[model samples]
Target: MSKLKVLGICGSRRDESVNMKLLRYAGSMVAAEGHDFEIFYFDDFPLPLFDSDEEAKTGIPENVHRLKQAVREADAIILASPEYNGSITPLLKNAIDWVSRTSARLQVTDEWKGKPVGLCSCSPGAMAGLRGLYHVRDIMVECGGLVISEQVSVGKAFEAFNEDGNLVDERTSGFLKAMISKLLEVSQALKKA
Candidate 1:
């Protein structure tokens, strides 16, 4: 099997974010599959709130270009986000808006088309940010990406993970494993086609 590159985009930018911890755990599993896994933290590369007028005025920001290229090169994406007001976080939506746009100067067209995506969410509430993930799915599909149906949402995120960043609950872990497997499978198949 060819080595596929899996990109993890963490939507929460807070220090010691539980969602980032979840992505780290997932990344380890991706690595164990003999694939390359990289996580992108919005905090590390900040883009101004996406604005078409800004794009016309200043062109794509260097950081936006960098992220767009990453998405283009990635075989699949895993997104772990915290629900904000019953919807996806602003950071993630903005990143999608930027990455989904065409950039002729950078030779980076819409990268979301045909991209396979795995969704995950962690929250302190009982709902586990599932509602937000639905919105995420909508946005991803609208951008022409294929979202995996097996998504993992862990409630009480503060208590969901152990020190190693692995899910503690056996049932949730199983769900995550299935989701990851599907993500890897679809990504490899899509790459071949």
Candidate 2:
């Protein structure tokens, strides 16, 4: 029963991104559960493409440092992304790449290690960004994150939300809630152990 800090990350940088809405909705739900939830948008902390030489020369960028600190502080993460050509978006992948880099100051790749994560995505296509979650899950595993099995993928995202910006379908909403619950449960257990 310690308060859990959950970080929600939106992959899209567009002004009115469906994926960002999805993430915000999830954050609201998490907050309602009496946990601390904060949303992180890639738009707010843009970073250059990952470059080893640049990292060696100038070290991690300030934005990357800020992002890494956020990830480290959070007990769990929720990633909301849109599928791009059946894969994770470049913005999300680049953020992951930057955070995965070894930080000389920290001397450890601990930002994501053993942290619980929930995956969700929204897209107008039938696949609903599901394929992209596969890649994202793989990357999280490689980064030493403990990804929750339950997930949500909102298909036909253009019509998935109501005028109030809430999910229209009960089934999809249930799946997202269940995923977040599972993430919290697992993270709390890990913290206790």
Q: Give the candidate number with the greatest TM-score.
A: 1
- Write down the TM-score for model 1: 0.96
TM-scores, all models, native as reference: 0.96, 0.96
Candidate 1 local lDDT, residue 103: 66
C-alpha local distance difference test of each model: 0.92, 0.89
Off by over 4 Å in 2: 105-108
Residue-by-residue lDDT tens digits, candidate 1, 31-140? 99999999876777898998878788888899988898899999999999999999999989999999999766746689999999999999989999899999999999
Q: What value does the lDDT take at residue 100 in candidate 2?
A: 79
**lDDT of residue 67 for candidate 1:** 94
How many residue pairs collide in each prediction? 0, 0
Q: How close is candidate 2 to the true structure, as a TM-score?
A: 0.96
lDDT of 2 by residue, 141-189 (tens): 9999999999999999999998888999999999999999999999899
